[model samples]
Target chain A: MGYHHIHRYRIAFVDCDPAQIVHFSNYFRWFDTASREFFTACGVPSWRDTERGSGLIGTPLVDAQASFRNPATYGEDIEIESWVDRWSGKSFVMRHVARRGDTVLAEGREVRVFAVRDSVDPPVIRAVAVPAGIRAMCGD
Target chain B: MGYHHIHRYRIAFVDCDPAQIVHFSNYFRWFDTASREFFTACGVPSWRDTERGSGLIGTPLVDAQASFRNPATYGEDIEIESWVDRWSGKSFVMRHVARRGDTVLAEGREVRVFAVRDSVDPPVIRAVAVPAGIRAMCGD
Candidate 1:
């Protein structure tokens, strides 16, 4: 268990499908944003600054999953609570729960790794070991 | 195994992150569009038309997973090859393979169910049995 961060956003008309409910994919986008917010709350510097100093480009997902619980519509304000669930040598797992008022909307998990630009010609990126300094900041 | 449909799109600048690579969440969005295109190619009518006739709102994902293989930047053109992998009594699995030319970028799978608006006050949706007619159209 690590620091939990809550990200708040209002659903836009474009976030919904013709069915008038939020598209399932948008939950993933929100979860991704919430994950970054969790790191920001933990005092981890922005990837831009880290890249300039340590070649840490950003966290990229190797796997991501979400389970839809309830349907929500546009104009609804939602909150995604995110936290780091586990940390490995090379990757970490992020968990997020989205809610509108008291109703749970969706739950998501992401397996991500710190990465750097390894090649430019083919636009390749490679994962690096978890940064100990950032991990310490996260209190894990 | 059903009809395979390919959906093509260009990555926009907004689709990229500060790292200058296409955000992983965008892959889920493309897979979703590809799933709809798969049904369109199979001769199924749009969800709006179906809802008017048969109370079928749309297919909503219960679970979605994607594994990133390579990084793609903005302005890159990508294609997602999508198809139905399995059909159950009340749900089906959709698989997608995203590629940049000959290079494979990501692979995705979604577990989805046909749904209908079960409630309006709180906007609840419920999954229904897989329609045989739609299955037939999908050649399954």
Candidate 2:
């Protein structure tokens, strides 16, 4: 288990839909932000920096899933707790839990891969093995 | 099978990450929009209208997943083909394929349920069975 990182933000009007609740997709966006925050907390450089040094473009998600547990509206402050739950050779699973106080609003899990830009024209990305330094930094 | 609804849009700069590719989360957002477009093309009323008439708030996602096949950048015009892939008693799976020309950019699937506001304060939502009329209108 790696260290947990927390990212907090208030819901905005644009994050809600006609149903007057935060759009479910917004949770995935917040989760992505939280994943980056987690990497930052682990002392990993920004994707841009890594890209220049090692051709590591970014960690791109291969799969993401979320279960909505409660409805939250704009003006509500929420926080996402994120951490790397599992790590494989070429991919890892990042887990996120969104909450407002004690209520769990949603739970999400993302399987992501460290990718590099393989082709410039028409842009293509290819997954690479989990970098050893990154794994150590993340306490895996 | 329901009629496929096509939603086309140009990717904006804001939709990309530091890698200059559309962030993976944005695919979920577009799939969501495509889900509603599918309903509109099937002649289903807006969520607001359904809410007033039958206590239906909107279809809320319970699960969402996407597989990236290619990377796309800002200013690229892409279209998503969306349809209801499966309808169950209380939920349905919406599927989407995003493409530019014949190149597939991504594939997404979402499990969603028709929900109604079951409580006022602190807002709670509950899923309802698939509406027969709506299913028929969707050609499911």
Candidate 3:
């Protein structure tokens, strides 16, 4: 019941492994899917359709990691609860929790930054401040 | 090296996120990376070039879940060694280990089955026996 952020999802058949449990990799993809949808629902343009493909801004993951608490399998429906807790100039924190009913499947956090499109190398990642509009919506 | 039926990979910076730790989701990507290399080395055709445009012989997960015993971070390398120990017709065992030079970051095993593409209400993930070639190589 928190306005912070929330995303719901179902485990697809392709999401599992030979062990009949969700592969660890799929969780990251799910996290990205839910988080992106949450942002889109909040009025942020789709990263894929941003700036008419001008690519002026993109949120590429400079770093990512996760810890597995339990297993998820095909046919399981789960919910992801998310929040934007702290923000620095260029970076912000995204926390996520995966659950089935009341059972906690996994907990994770991601630190991301705003990157500008560059012609060469990768976009420079900096520690700049969060945009004012985003801050107002995310509620610092 | 003996056809020991296992490959080990050490997690590294390139494999982690800004949390200065491993994201639970990155594990599946790495698992795919390691498994692909291992199978190709064992003589399985490239996943894409197969005549089936990726044949019906698909390694799909039936279940997957993990537990974190330790944290892995930037510049640290951990081993991800995998093996196929159990095979009964269409299903097999793939175990992966994330470790430092000697310390284990995480250890997990997945249960997988080879299923055909089914177009139905809910795709029936029927288990087929492990192909002879794969069994010979992995059932060491």
TM-score for each candidate, following the candidate numbering? 0.94, 0.93, 0.52
Least well predicted 10-residue stretch by lDDT in candidate 1 chain A: A116-125
Per-chain TM-score of chain A in candidate 1 equals: 0.97
Residue A92 C-alpha lDDT in model 1:
95
Tell me how candidate 2 scores on lDDT. 0.90
Off by over 4 Å in 3: A48-56, A120-128, B1-28, B35-140
| DockQ of prediction 2 | 0.67
Q: Worst ten-residue run, lDDT, model 3 chain B?
A: B117-126
Query: Which lDDT value does model 2 have at B113?
Result: 94
Q: Give the per-residue lDDT of model 2 (tens digit) for A76-122.
A: 99999999999999999999999999999999999999999898855
| Least accurate 10 contiguous residues by lDDT in model 2 chain B | B117-126
Highest TM-score against the true fold, candidate = 1
Candidates sorted on DockQ, descending = 1, 2, 3
Task: Quote the lDDT for A35 in model 3.
Answer: 69
Better model by TM-score, 2 or 3?
Answer: 2
In order, the Cα lDDT scores of the candidates are 0.90, 0.90, 0.61
lDDT of candidate 1 over B29-135, digit per residue (tens)? 88988998989899899998998899999899999999999889878899999989999999999999999999999999999999998877566789999999999
Question: Could you tell me the lDDT of residue B85 within candidate 2?
Answer: 90
> Could you tell me the interface RMSD of model 1?
1.3
Query: What level of docking quality does candidate 2 show?
Result: medium
Provide the lowest-lDDT 10-residue window in model 3 chain A: A118-127
Please write out the lDDT profile of model 3 over residues B33-117, one tens digit for every residue: 6666667677777544442653444566554444445555655555677766566666666767666777765665666766554
